[model samples]
Target chain A: MKVESLVFMLITFAVITLITVSLFIKVLKNNKNSDEISEEEQ
Target chain B: MPKNEQWGTRVGLILAMAGNAVGLGNFLRFPVQAVQNGGGAFIIPYLVCFLLMGIPLLWVEWTIGRYGGSHGNHSTPFILDKMGKKFFWKYIGVFGIFSNIAIAAYYCYIESWTMSYVYHSLIGTFRGMDQSQVAGFFSDYLDVFTSTTGIPYEAIIFYIICLALNTWILSRGLNAGVEKTAIIAMPLLILFGIFLAIQGVTLTSGSRGAVFDGTVGLNFLWTPEFDSLLNPKVWLAAAGQIFFTLSVGMGSIQCYASYVKSRKDIALNAMSAGWINEFVEVVIGSCVIIPISIGYLGIDKVIELTTTGGLGLGFRTLPFLFQQWGDLLAVLAGVSFFGLLFFAGITSSLAMGTPLMGFLQDEFKFNRQKSALIFGAIIFLMGMPTVIFFNEGVFDEYDYWAGTVSLVVFALFEAILFAWVFGIDKGWKELNKGAEIKVPYVYKFIIKYITPLLLAIVFIGATIRPENDDWSKLSFSGWELHNESIIGQLIHKGIKYNNTYFSDYFKSEVDGVVDSVYHFKGRDYILISYIDEKGLTHTVSYNYSGNELTVNLGQIVNAGDIIFKGFVINRIFYIDMARLLLLTMFISISVLVYIAAKKRKQEKENK
Candidate 1:
C-alpha cells in the first residue's frame, strides 16, 4: 500500500478499536457499579 | 397507556441498532458508490449529508420511538398520530408500514442468495471454473434467461430456508432473538471484514495480468477529483448513500428504538451506532472490496466490474477472484467472504421484520410469536414474484420502487412531521431528554429547515431521472471522443459525419440484412449484419428514439456508415408511469382516509 493510504488505514483502525474498547469498558464499569449498589442494599 | 416491551440491556439495544444499520450495502454498495462518484471527493458531500441528513434523522427516529413508546405507540402510524395533532400524520405514517413490508419481501430473497453462495463457496462449487463460467454460475442461480438445473428448485428451497431462519429468530422476541443474533453476528462481520481486508492489502502481486497491489486500489478510492464536488449528481449520490447506509427513513429504526426504556440515553447510543456503521463501511468496507478486486483484476477491470453494480461485485467477480487464489486457499477465502455476507445480510434482513412485528403487536394485539409467523408467511407469498420472475425485471421493480424511491419519500415525511408539524423545539427537547452528549443547538434549525429541503430536492431529482437509465453513457461517450483508435475506427467504418440525429437513410443502411428487431416503449431497434474491409462479418444495431437515433455501441461496428445521434428524450416507460401513479394514489387515499376518520371522530365527540 502507498504510505499515505497505509497511514489512513492505520488511523481509522486505531480510532475504531479505541471506540469499541471504550464502549465495552463503559459497559463493564456500569455493571460493576450496579453490582456494588446491590451488595450495599443487601 | 399500554405496557411496552423494553430492551434487555443497553448494550443489546446499541448492537441491535448498529446491526440494523450495517448490511450488505456497507460491504458491497458503499465502495462502488464512492469510487464511481469521484472517489475521495465523494466524501465531502457524503460527510455533509451525514451531518445535515443522517445524524439529524437518526435522532428524529430515535426520539420519536422513545416518545411514542412511552405512550404505548410502537408502530409509525400510532407514533405519528401521537406526535402530530392532525390525523393526516398517521395516514402519512402508512409509508413506513408499506416500505418495511415491501422491502422485507425482496430483501429476504436477496439474503437467501447470500446464504446459497455461502454453501456453494464452502463446497468449492466455484473452484476450477473460468471467469465466464463463474459469471454463468450466478446467472444460472438467478435462473436468468435459462436455468442450468432445469428448474429453480434450489432458489425456492434456499429462499424458504432463509425465511424460516428469520422468522424463527424474530419469533423468539426482541432480547432473545434479534438482539442475541446481532451480538454474535455483528462482531463476526467486523472480524471477517478486517481479516479479508488484511489479506487484501497483503496481496502484493496478482496472477492473470493483474500486476497491481492493494495500494493501487486504495489510491483509486482515496484520490479525489475536486471538480466532482461541484456536480449535483455526486451530491445526490452521497446523500442517498447516507440514507441507505444509516438505515434512516425506514420505520425499523423507530421500531427498534421503541424497545428502549423511555428515559434511556438515545443521543449517545444513536451516535455510537452511526460511528460503528461508518467504521464498518468506510474503513473495512472500502479496505476489503476495492483493494482485493483491484489486486485480482487490476484497477481498470475492477472499475468496469463496479459499473455493473453490487451483485456483479459481490456475487460474480469476487467469486471469480477467489478461484484465482489456487485451490485450498480459494475455498477458504470464498467461504469466509460469503459467510461474512450471509451474516451481514441476515442481521439487516432481521431488522426489516421488526417494524411489521411491532405493527402487528401494537395494532392487532398479536403475540410476538404469532406476529412473527404471520409476517413471515406474508413476506414469503409477497416475495414469490421476485423468485419466480427473477430474470423478468420483477426484482428490480420492487427494489427500485419500494427499496429506493419509497425510502426517500418516507424519510421526507419523517423530517417534515418531526421538524415542522410536530415542532422543532419540541423535537429538540425530546432528543436531548436522555442525552449523554449534547447536540449543538444549531441542529434544531437545520432539522427544521435544511434536512427536509435537502430530502425534498433528492426526492424530486430522483423522480425526474429515469429509472434504469444508465448515467455512465455520457462518460463512455466522452471516453470514445478522447480515444484516437476508437474514433478512427468509427470514422473509417462510417462514410459520413457523426452527429446526433434519426434519419430514414441511416435506418435503411441496416434494414436489408436485419437479423432481429425488438420494441421497447415506442422505439424500434434493428440488428443488422455488416462486413468490414477484412471480410469479417458482424452484427450492429441502432435505436430509433422517435425523433432521433442515438447509437453508442462500444465496439460492435465492423464496417458501415453510422451516425451517432444524441437527444433529450423525456419519454416515460410503463413501469415509471405505474410507479408514479401508485405513489400518488397511495398518498391521496391516505389523505382521504385521514379526513373521513377525522369527521367520524368529531361526530362521535359531538354526539
Candidate 2:
C-alpha cells in the first residue's frame, strides 16, 4: 500500500479501537447487575 | 408539529431515500458527464467520493433524522438544538430549504421536456429526419412551445400534470405517495430499461457500420487519456458530478430519512442504492451512450460530439441517430429510449420536490397538502425560465448553485455536526440494534475518518472556481469543435437511415467512420475472444441478430458441456478486482471482530 493508504489504515484502526473500547466500557457500566445472569447461563 | 403518527412505513422510507438518490443525476447527468470527462477516469474520483463521502454523509443524515423525528423536529436547527448548538446554526436549515426549492424549480422544467419528447416520438413526428432537420424540428418545437401562444401550452400542461401528481402524492403522506411511487417507478424503470437494452441490441443488425467504434462507445468510456485525467478541470467535473449524482448534502435525503423509524437501517439502504446507481452508470449507461455515439460520430470524434451540452448529448443526439437508422427496429428503439428517459426524469423530479415540501411543512407548520401545493406551484413558476428561454445558461446557473455548491456545503456541515457535535457513539447504537448482520467495528472507523475525508475532497474540489472560463460565458468550452463535426457530417449525408442515399451522396468525400466499410450495418457489434487453459485462442463473432446475439465461433459450441477455459479474458471481468477485495476485507474484518468481541465478553463474565 502507498504511504497515504497505510496512514489511512492506521487511523481507521485507531478510531475503531477507541470506539469499541468506549462502547465496551459503557456496556459494562450499564449491565453490571446482569453479570450474574451471564455467568449462571454459561 | 404533529406526532410521529403520520410518518412513513419502513418500506416507504426506503423508497423515499431511493427516489431522492436515483433521479436525473443517475439517468441524465451520469452517462453524459462520464463520457465528457474521460469515462473510466471519471469513475476513479466518483468511486472515491462514494466510499469516503456518500455513505458517511448518509449515516449522518439518518442518525440526525431519526433522533430529531423522535423529538418531532425539522432539519439542522431543530436537531442541533438538542445537540447543544445555539440558534445561529438554524441558518443552515433555512439555507437547505432555499436550496431544495431552487433545485425543484429548474428540475421540474427539465422534467417537462421528457413529456414533450414522449408525445412527439409516439406520434411518429420524429421519423425520417436528417441531423439538421431533426435539430431544426426540436428548435422549432421549442420556439413554438415557448412563444406566448406556442408549444409552451403542451409543456405547461404536462408540467402541471407532473407537479400535481407530485403534490397529490406528497399530500397523501410518505407511504401513499413517496414510497408507493418509488416502488412502482423503480420496478417500471428496471423493466423499461430491460426493454430498451433489448431494443438496442436489435438495432445492431441493420446497415449502419461498425457498432463497436470506441470513438463514442467503449473508447470514450474506458480509454484513459491521462492528460484529461490530470487536468484540474476534469477533477472539478468529477467532484461536481459525484456531488450532483448522489444527491448528498441536499437535505433531500435528510427530509426523507426524517420520516424513517429509528430502527430502520439507513447506511445499508444508502449503500444499496449507491451500488445500484454505479452499476447502472457503468454497465447499462455505458452500453447505451457509447454504442449510440460510436454509430453516429465514430470513435475519435465521439468525445468531441458528446462535449456539446449535457442535455443535448443524450436527448437530442440519440433520437437523431435512431431516425438515421430508419426501419421498424429504429422506430421501436426510439420509443423505448424516450420512455426510459421519461421514467428517469419523473423519479428524480419527485425526489427534488420532497425536501422542499418537507421543509415547508416542518418549518412553517403547513399541512402536507398545503405544503405540497404551495411548493409545487413555486417549482412550476420557477421552472418557467428554463422552459421559456430554451437556453442552457439559466439551467447551468441553477445546476451549479443549487445542485453542486449548496448541496455539498449543507452535507459537509451535517457530517461535522453528526460526527463531532451530536456524537458518533449514539449513531452506532441505533445502527447496530436489530441488524441481521452484526455491525462491524470498522464502520466506526469509516464514519469517523474515511467518509469525512472523501466529502471534504469532493466538496472542496467542486467549488474551485474556474480561472479560464468566465461564469457569464455562454459558449461551452468544446461546443464549437464538436457541433461543427456533427453539422458537417449531417450536411454531407442527407438521409437518416437509407444507406444507399447516404453512401451515394457522401462516398469518397467524408473522413470519419462514415467513409469506412461498415456504414450501413448498425454499428453495434461484439467481438469475443477466449484464450483457454491450453493456450488455445477462440475468436468469435457476436452481433445483434434480430434482438439476440448471433454467436458464430467457426467451431462446434455445445451448451452444458464442460469446456475447460484457462483464463477469463474480458475487460468486464478484470476491472471488478479492487471492489471485490474491499468487500472481502470489510466482511472478513467484521466477522473476526464480532467473534473476538463475543469471546472477550464471555471471559470477562467468567471472571
Candidate 3:
C-alpha cells in the first residue's frame, strides 16, 4: 500500500512538473526573441 | 494619493495571492485524504477540478478586476452594475469580505497552533510523546490556546503578532507589502517543502515499496475507484477540496486581481497562479502526507486518519508518527514539518486578509493601513470562539460553512457573472491588450461552458449529501486474535474449521503482520479460497486460533488460479496517463510558444 501511494504521488509530481515545465518552456520559447514591451503596453 | 494603485509588477500579485490561496489545509488535508481514498483515483477528480474549474474561475475573477480597472475597487458592485443586476449582487459582494473576516478569525487561532508547536519543539516537549500522550498534549494545548474569561494573554500575544504582521504589510501598500512578502515567502515555502520531502523519503521506512498492487498505494491513488467515486462522500470531498484549496468564492481572488495592470493577461496569469497553487498545495503536499502515513499507519489507517475528526489529523496523527522515529529524528522532523506548516498558514492568512483589506478600502475609502488594522481587530475578536470553544467544534463549523459551502456557491456565481453577463467580448479585449501571448478562443469556451458546468455538478454533489461525521469507526482486518485469559487461551486451541489450509498459507505468505483482526465471539470462522501449487482451485473455512488461522478444506477444485496481472497493467496505465496529460499540456504550450516566436521572427525579418 505504501509503495503504491508513493508511486502515485511521484507520478502526480512528475505529471504536474512536466506540464508546468512544458508550458513554461513554451512561454520562454515564444518570448525568447521578442522585444520587451514598454511600461505603457504592460 | 493615486487612488488605488496597480501591483508594481505581476509576479508579486501572483505570489501574494498564491500564498493566500495555498494553506495548511492543502498541505495538511489533501495528502491524507488522497492516501486514504485510493491514491491515484483521488488524483483523477482533483486534476479534473483543477483544469476545468479552478483555472477558468481564476480567469473570470481576473477579467473582472482588469476590465473594471480603477473602478474595479468595488468588485461585486462594479460587476453587478455592468451585468445589469446591481440590486441583487451588491449585497453578495459582502459574502467574500464576510467570509474572509470569519475565516481570518479562526485562521489566526489555527496559525497559533503552529506557534505552540514551534515553542514546544524548542523546549523539547515532543521528546517523549507517544501517540496517546501526543493526543493528550494537544487537548491540553487547546485549553491555553483559547481563553474562556476574556482573551488569554498567550492567545492575545500570537493574535497580535499575526494581526501586526498583516497590518504592517498592508501599510507598505501592495508593492512593498503584499508583493514583497509573496516573492520571498513563496520560494521559501517551496524550498522548505522540497527539503522536508527529501528528508521524509530518505527515512528508512519511507523508501520501502508499497503493500498492495491496487487501490492500496500508488496505483490505488490514481486508479479510478468507480465504486468510491459513485459515493457522495468522494464527490463532496473533491468539491470541498477545490473550493478551500483555491481560496476562491471569497472575493479574495477578485481583490488581488483588482490591482493588476489593465493590460496584464488575465487568462495566462490566472492559469499560471492556479497551476502553481495546485502543484505546491496538492502535489507536494501529497508527497509529504502520503509517504509518512503509509510508513507509520499502513494503508487502511491512512484512510481512517484522513477522515478522522475534521482537520485535526495534522495535529494529532503527525505527532504520533514523529514520535515513532525516536528522539533525535523525531524532534528534527517535528520542528521541520511544523515549521513548514507555520509558513503555509501565514501565507494563506495574508492572502485572505488582502480581499478584506481591499473591500474596506474600496467601500469605506479608508487607506490600506487603517483598513487592515480595523478589520484585523474584528477578525481577532471573531476568532475567539474558534480558539476557546471546545464542544461545538466552532472551528470545524467555520471551516465547513464559510470555507466549503459558501466558497463553492460564490465561485459559481462569479463565473456566471463574468463569462455570461459581464460579456466575454470586453473581458477578451482587456486580457489580450498587453498580453504577449493571445489567449485562445478556447478560453472563452471554457469560461462559459466548461468551468461553470463543472463547478455546478461538483457543488451539487458536495452540498446534496450529508458529510461523513465519524470517519474513525472504519477499520481493516490483518489478523484474528481471540482475547482470552491465559487458561482460556489453551482451551481455544481445540477450535475446528472447514478450510484450515487457507489460514496456514495466508500466514506463511505474510511473515509477521500486525494483529489487527479481532474475533467477535469465543469462536468465530472465515471462508477462504485460492488456487494451490498445482493450479487447482480450493475452498476452505478457517477458525482463527489466537493470532493464527487454521483452515479446513471443503473442496479441491480444478480451475486455474485467477490472474491479477490485468489489474496490475491497468494500474500502470492510469498513472502513466495522468503523467502524460500533465506533461503534454506543458510541452504543448512550450512548442506552441516556440512556433509563435518563429512566426513573429519571420514577420519581423520580412518587414
Best by TM-score: 1
Worst 10 contiguous positions by lDDT, candidate 2 chain B: B507-516
lDDT of 1 by residue, B1-607 (tens): 1134566666677788989899889889999998899886787788789889998899999999888888777778778988987856888777776777777888888889888888888878887788888887787687633445444478888899999999999998887898899889988888888888887777777453356787788888877678888777788889989988998888888988887666667887887888788888887888888888888778777777786587788888888888777788777778778778888888888888877677667655689889899879978877876787655445766677778877898899989989888888888988998676778888898999999999998886665432222334344334222111223322332223222222333423432355566674355665767664545555655555543433343324333444433343211232243345446645653664466456647876999
Question: Across residues B1-607, which tens digit of lDDT does each residue of candidate 3 receive?
Answer: 0245666655566667778778887778777666555455777766766666776677677767666554655444444444545445544555666567667777877787776676666667766667777766676566554432244556557666867776677667777777887788788888878876665555454233323222233334444455565554554466567777888787777777777656445665666677777888655775566656565567666565565532566787676776666677667777777777777788777767776566555545678778777767767666665665533345655665566665777788777777777667766666666665557778778887888887787665443222132223333642233212112222232123211312222222211212223353354444446555545444343334343333223422222222111111222222233334333433443343345335545876999
Candidate 2 lands at a TM-score of 0.67
Candidate 1, overall lDDT?
Answer: 0.74
Candidate lDDT (C-alpha), each: 0.74, 0.55, 0.60
Per-residue accuracy of model 2 over B543-594 as CA lDDT, tens digit each: 2222322233332333322122222222212213322332343344334334
CAPRI verdict (incorrect, acceptable, medium, high) for model 1: acceptable
- For each candidate in turn, the TM-score is 0.79, 0.67, 0.71
**CAPRI verdict on model 2?**
incorrect
Clashing pairs for predicted structure model 1, backbone only? B500-B565, B500-B566, B501-B565
Native-to-model Cα distance after best TM-score fit, residue B46 in candidate 3, in Å? 1.5
| Candidate number of the best DockQ | 1
lDDT at residue B503 of model 2 (Cα atoms):
18
When 1 and 2 are scored with lDDT, the better candidate is: 1
Q: What is the interface RMSD of candidate 3, in Å?
A: 4.8
DockQ of each: 0.30, 0.03, 0.21
lDDT for B302 in candidate 2 is: 54
